[model samples]
Target: MSDARAPASVEVEGLTFHYPGAEDPALREVAFRVRPGERLGLLGPNGAGKSTMMRIACGYLPVPRRRGTKVRVAGLDVATQSLAVREQVGYLPEQVPLYQELRVREHLEFRAAVKRVRRRARRAEVERVAGLAGLEDMLETPIGRLSRGYRQRVGIADALLGSPPLVVLDEPTVGLDPNQVQGIRTMLKNLGGAQTLIFSSHILAEVEALCDRIIILSRGAVVADETVSAALASDTLSIEWGRPSSGGGGEGDAIRGAAVQACLEQAWSRFDAAGPLEVELSVVGDRVQATVVSGPVALDELAAAIGAESLAAGLPLVRLEPGRRRLEERFAVVTGFREAPERAKGGRS
Candidate 1:
């Protein structure tokens, strides 16, 4: 990577920080880089130092006593050019502090001025960002009167004031309706190419959707830094298949269910014969549900084989489709967090 001219937009080496009266350090030798145009998601359970790292990156917290450890933002030393580093970053905190008395337009205009936007183009810039954040309609409305969703938009608008290349957003979509979440996601995706974004979220779905890469933290250290595809590569491909008959007879339903079960058993037997294998199959409704835990197989292949074998026995192929991967299951397996049966886990997703 030496000849690569440091693809990193932000770099940190040997970063460690401790809080007053804390038994352990909040960050310990945390080292990672945010490459130019990379949308990196920081993910962790509660109290995993994700927020601490964000604070350090935003210059809200100071480095430890050891000096010259090396932290840089936009090629400026975070230790020395602290003010310059702050000037180049746009930070959206989790609480989203804003003056409730100010109108949406007034709040954005005030932030732009604080960021030293030029007098001639400040209004135009404010309007452009307001539109970008979908705040155009509420520009004249008081912030306190806006909904939680609109308040979030105003916070995002404030962060974009100086046209900073690096944007750090914390829990940008915590309490929004589906439509509001969609709007925020669309805006972030639109900004992906022009800005280097580092967002932290406890919601796995959000990270999977918005981030090109993810850095999962556990116990105040980096546990995983990989693309979503890489993180979920070992997931099982669930298959469901059923046979249809001329009429909806009870016998036909039973036969279809039995055939699907037989197909799954046969597949598992085949896999076992090929190698040491572990799999699971069961009946769900009129179809058979199967999960092959060991090796990866394509959904089409599993469905096609089952369909062909069923049709050879004079049964009509009814339905065949792939099931979505359960992110919680994959997380448990990868992170070694053994969970009870999903239904038994308080029935909360």
Candidate 2:
């Protein structure tokens, strides 16, 4: 993934996978790289391939047989050097697998043994992870007797075994209560880049809170790969507009509704290519204002183009300011859950 002395923390290239007898591939030409010590969040709806991708990266699922696909962990190929990759990854799946009869401490010790920790050092290793997961008090309690939150902590502790270089967690906070979720999030945050972390969750807030970078998957394709700031910004621009002159000295109110929308469409049409913008129009007192948002775009160039368009049409441009889209809506546009504003007659998208 890079020329650095250490290989990428995790890497995927031209990855595509299909379940047996499935019509559509679960993942389609997906490619991304996770940097060493970075926290990456995988975000998508159900069946969006988030879990499948994680499984493939963890070596639990096989990479496609096709030649173009490659999956690697810590510079080791997952398809060929899975044993070595396993040694470098600690994985927690959507469902926690635990032996109900075993106590928390015993479960961790067994996992450490399975991970091949040295015989004499397994107990000390188990204690270390338990403390990180806040499971010291529950270490002696049988897993079946512990609360759901405690059980989740046990699963996390198990994954932390051996201090693997890459830690992959799939929906680790799915069923936990608010307090439980907060506790687990804080614990993982405290890891502080000790190991690279890749996690998935349906909760956008949780993902934004825990990850410095995020990769959004949609219908098996990589839709967005951005740092938290860039992802949320969505390159929004808010403009305050005035009515264009109607071939006379006085400004006309005719450009209030559809005319305003047409002005925008025509302005954007001037460019060779422009990202689709979600336009929202509102009237403050007697003034007409619009909030426009799009994915990454050339703000300075666009602002100039838009200004030129307004001048050409004799539409007085009152103001041109930049703003951010609502956090959740930034995702909606890319995920196809919502469409842009359809009208300017006091209508909002």
Candidate 3:
């Protein structure tokens, strides 16, 4: 189920595959497009062929030699021009194979040579990549002795040896501390606007933070492909308020929600609205719990109108902030993690 619904940067058509000695095809009629300069996160549970697809993209695994079309990388035909396609793409596999005995500088040089970096600027090129990857300090350190983060950086440096337009990173941050993860994410975010990057990870949060869009694959097919903001924006709202205590709970304090709702209703009278907006409000100690539909009305205006009136009536005002119905919550809703009868929708809980 590819998103034939939108324009594509990379396109695949009628893709089918079966691994040697495997019982079934790893991929089946998979078709999707990754837009140019877009960071698309590939997500799936174990054994869903995410790695297989990445391998195909990198030319490690050959597409089935059949009459029908299959896969392509960077608009180059994978079936007929895989070699040329690979040259235009950079791949960092899960293991990040490197020569442990070689120093960081040496490993990069070796990779540069293998990638056919020109002789005239090889030295400067490795130095430049080392600086970009934050490998300057450890350039003289042996690859085997470096931490997981540093080793990953070395791998990335190698992949970026030629500054290819497309870079595929397979779980580049699989095992690293929080700081290291943030560092990598920051680096990638800084690099995103200039180059197209495709990264695979099981961590949805990482995808949420780094990728502009996400694609969830299940059973070798795309189940979701949407902009990261669109995905998160669907179920969340941005709310603003001041400290409740400052509003001075007046006589009308008890009817704050009702009053606010009424004010919104009055303001919305110009147009035939969609019934009432869905909102979840609660109070835990001093913090107000709110889940309101995001709209054009600025928080300052809503807060001023509601808070001023509420304060005059004896309620508190507080600052406003954006709130999210977390990614896991959205995932559960879409995937039906919890099941109930149709009547469940009618019962308020």
Maximum-lDDT candidate: 2
Looking at candidate 1, what is the lDDT of residue 164? 82
Model 2 agreement with the true structure over 197-303: per-residue lDDT tens digits: 89988888887788889998889999888887787664657888765444222243434644566767776666566555557776555566876654455776667
Query: Model 2 misses residue 219 by how many Å?
Result: 1.9
lDDT against the true structure, per candidate, is: 0.71, 0.79, 0.68
For model 2, what is the C-alpha lDDT against the true structure? 0.79
**Order by lDDT, highest first:** 2, 1, 3
TM-score of every model versus the real structure: 0.75, 0.74, 0.78
Against the true structure, candidate 2 reaches a TM-score of 0.74
Off by over 4 Å in 1: 1-8, 65-68, 235-275, 282-289, 295-324, 330-349
Question: Clash pairs of candidate 1?
Answer: none
The number of residue pairs in model 2 that clash at the backbone is 0
Regions of candidate 3 where Cα sits further than 4 Å from its true position: 1-9, 66-68, 235-251, 264-277, 283-289, 293-323, 331-349
- Runs in model 2 deviating more than 4 A are 1-8, 237-322, 341-349
